[model samples]
Target: MPRRGKVVLVQVAIVLSLLLVWESGVRAGLIDPFFFPAPSTLVARIGEWMSTADFWTDVGVTLLETILSFVAGIAIGTTLGIWLGLNPFAAEVVQPFIKMFNAIPRILLGPIFVIWFGLGLTSKVALGVTLVLFVAFFNTFQGVREVNPVVLANARLLRASKWSLLRHVYLPSATTWILSSLRVSVGMAVMGAVVAEYLGSSAGLGHLIAQAEGVLDAAGVFAGIIVLSAFVVALDAVVDRAEKRLLVWRPAPAHEV
Candidate 1:
């Protein structure tokens, strides 16, 4: 079997094993169903939720918020990162302020965002943007800063225009770093949206989970969590595919024959 297939098989096996163990424990009265629903029950609950239109609407809202956050964060972060990276003086001046903002726990900003933007998609997207922005900025800044001095000098010797240099030299150099940051930012974006929804929203998976928790419906909560997990996994997979396509120039690691 191919390595990827084998890896996937193992992952599936591991999950099944865990589910089997959990189900067995529940049946044996070794685990409390109220707190920890059986895997089967969780699956059934998820199916039931999926059959409803409300669930899909919640998913769509969450997905929209996440996508908006990811794109806005990347656009703003990349621009600022490139600017500050090229202008060392400006970077130095703003470094303290950036650090201070980054130090602020983003979760605390959720309620503030809700109040500022209202308890809707805007607030969720704002919170997610905050969560994702720093990650992209740091990675992109380092990427641009780490560009090869020799390559830059050669480009300068060729009388490359600023735009030409940015397009050909800087962006290409930073692509890898930016993409790496994107993978990490995916989870951050999702967390931001969900947390914001949980804090003050009428819809989204987070609201669903929050509702379930309020009613002490363990199965519903677990089912919501499972759905969210799958959602993240799907987004991560899309990122993975995009990364592969964009980084086709990247060399593959060597393998022993």
Candidate 2:
């Protein structure tokens, strides 16, 4: 078999083995069903949830919030990163304030956002943007600062305009850094949305889990978790595809071969 196929097969085997063990333990009364639902029960619960329209709506809400946060964070972060990177004095002036904001635990801000924006989409998106923005900003700032001085000098000597330099020089140099941050930002975005929902929201996966937890329904909670895990995996796969397409010029590592 191809390496990828073999790897996937092994992974499947491992997961199945673990699930089998868990199910067996539950059946033998070695595990408490109330605390840890059987894998089968979780699967069934997920299927039942999927059959409902409300579940789909919750998914859509979470997805919209995640996408909004990811895009807005990247756009704003990259713009500021590039600006600060090019302007040393400005960066110095804002450095302390940026650090102060970044140092604040983002999770604690969820309630504040909910209070400001209410328990709605805006609060969730705001929370997610905070989680994602700093990651993009720091990576991009570093990338821009790390641009080769020689190349920059050469471009300037060639009479390149500022726009031309930014387009041809800074952005290309920072693309890898910016893209690398995206994978991390995806999870951050999801966490922000879910946490905000869990804290105070009427919909989304987080709300589902929160509702389940309130009722002490282990199966429902686990099922919600499984769904969220799958969602994150799907988003990560999309990011992987985008990364491969954008970095086609980059050489593949030996393992991928």
Candidate 3:
């Protein structure tokens, strides 16, 4: 088997071993089930959720919010990042404003968004966009600015048009940074959407978790968290696939024979 496949298998084995230990420890009363629910209990709760139509609805709502916010944030960030990266004057002019917004706690804006957009998908998506935007923006900006000066000079010497230079030079260079940052950006998008739901929302995993916490059901909370983690892992897998496809021109790392 490939080294990557072996690594994945080992990781799965480790998780399974830990889960077994957790379940055994809880059942044997070595650990408090109240504070740390057994893996079996959490799994059962997850199963119960899977059987409910409402659970699917909540999943859909959260997924929609995450996707919308992630897409919008990436679009806006890439555009502005590229523009500012190429124009030193514009970057300098907007630096302080960017820093100011970035420094503010995104969670604090959740209530404000709820007030502005109400307890709906729009508010959640808006909050997520805010969370994801700067991460993508900064990565793209840095990537573009860091492009090789010699390569650029050579491109210009070759009489490359502005559009051609951007397509063949600038975008390719920034793609690496943008793609790497998108993994974090996607997680932030999910966090933002879920947090907005926690504040005020009719549906979503965050709302479910909030409800669980309100009732002091540790199993329910753990189940909800596990479900949310699954979503994030799945989304991250998608991002990984996208990165591989889009960055096919990039050289693969050397592997031992």
In angstroms, give how far residue 194 of model 2 lies from its true place.
0.3
Q: After best superposition, candidate 3 residue 180: deviation in angstroms?
A: 1.5
What candidate 3 gets wrong by more than 4 Å, as runs, is: 1-9, 255-257
At residue 81, candidate 2 shows an lDDT of 96
Give candidate 2 misplaced runs (Cα > 4 Å).
none
Compared with the true structure, what per-residue lDDT tens digits does model 1 show for residues 1-257? 99888989999999899999999999999999999999989989988888999999999999999999999999889999999999999999999999999999999999999889998899999999999999989988999999999999999999999999999999989889999877799999999999999998999999999999999999998899889999999999999999989999988869832
Worst 10 residues of 1 by lDDT: 248-257
Clashing pairs in 3: none
Q: Write the per-residue lDDT of candidate 2 for residues 112-228, one digit (tens) a residue.
A: 999999998999999999999999999889999999999999999999999999999999888899888788999999999999999999999999999999999989889988999
User: TM-score of each candidate?
Assistant: 0.96, 0.97, 0.94
**Considering summed lDDT, which 10 consecutive residues are worst modelled in model 3?**
248-257
What does the lDDT read for residue 151 in candidate 2?
99
